[model samples]
Target: MSGEDFEDALKYTLQRKGWKLSTTKKTGDFGADLIGHDPKGRKVVIQAKRWNSKVGVDGVNQVIAAKAYYRADHAMLVTNQYLTNAAFELAKRTGVEVWSRKRLNAEIEANIPSKSNK
Candidate 1:
């Protein structure tokens, strides 16, 4: 999928989970893609990536950098593909949440709004 589509899904999933979503539009920038607050007002920073292949440790490093740069209380990396072993290890070591496509889709599905009420 395209980067924009992945970003939209990430925002939708977060919003459904009671997080406020904000976006940043930039090219070749080092900032996180979105900033948000949880239902209890905890700070969050998100980086959405649309990679046709596996995401590596470099992606995790960038997320970590952005998290620190923004002073966010929590951080997540939402990607369209699975992360490499190195990437997962890095995220684990740094306490960053990595959402793969399958996991992300499950979150989205679980939180999907019922159409019956609308």
Candidate 2:
């Protein structure tokens, strides 16, 4: 999937999870790709990566900077490919959640209505 596809999927998943979603705001320069809010209005900063190869820690660092810059309550890194070990370590250290393709798929599935009922 392309970067845009991943972003779209992320937005869809968030909405399915009952989040209030917004695109990159023009006036607010969070340096992050997307901004979401939970039912209680907690901020969620999302960084997207649709790389053909594994994403390294640099991408994670960039998003981390954006998270601090934005003062978000929580941050997530969503990628089509897997994150490197260094990236995982960086995310763990920075309190950013890393969601790989498999994780994303599972989350999407869990949020969706059961096929048997639907």
* CA lDDT, every model vs. true structure: 0.83, 0.80
Models 1 onward score TM values of: 0.88, 0.83
Return the top candidate by lDDT: 1
Estimate, for each residue in 1-118, the C-alpha lDDT of model 2 and write its tens digit.
6566667777887887789877785445455778868677888888888788988998788788777887889888888789889998999998988888798778878877777976
Name the runs in model 2 displaced over 4 angstroms: 25-30, 112-118
Record all residue pairs in model 2 with backbone atoms less than 3 Å apart, i.e. clashing. none
Enumerate clash totals for all models, in the order shown. 0, 0
- Least accurate 10 contiguous residues by lDDT in model 2: 23-32
Candidate 2 positional error at 44, Å: 1.2
- Which numbered prediction scores highest in TM-score against the true structure? 1
Which tens-of-lDDT digit does each residue in 1-118 have in candidate 1? 6687778878888887888978766664455888878788978788888988999988888879888887889888888789999999999989998888898778878988789867
**Model 1 score (lDDT):** 0.83
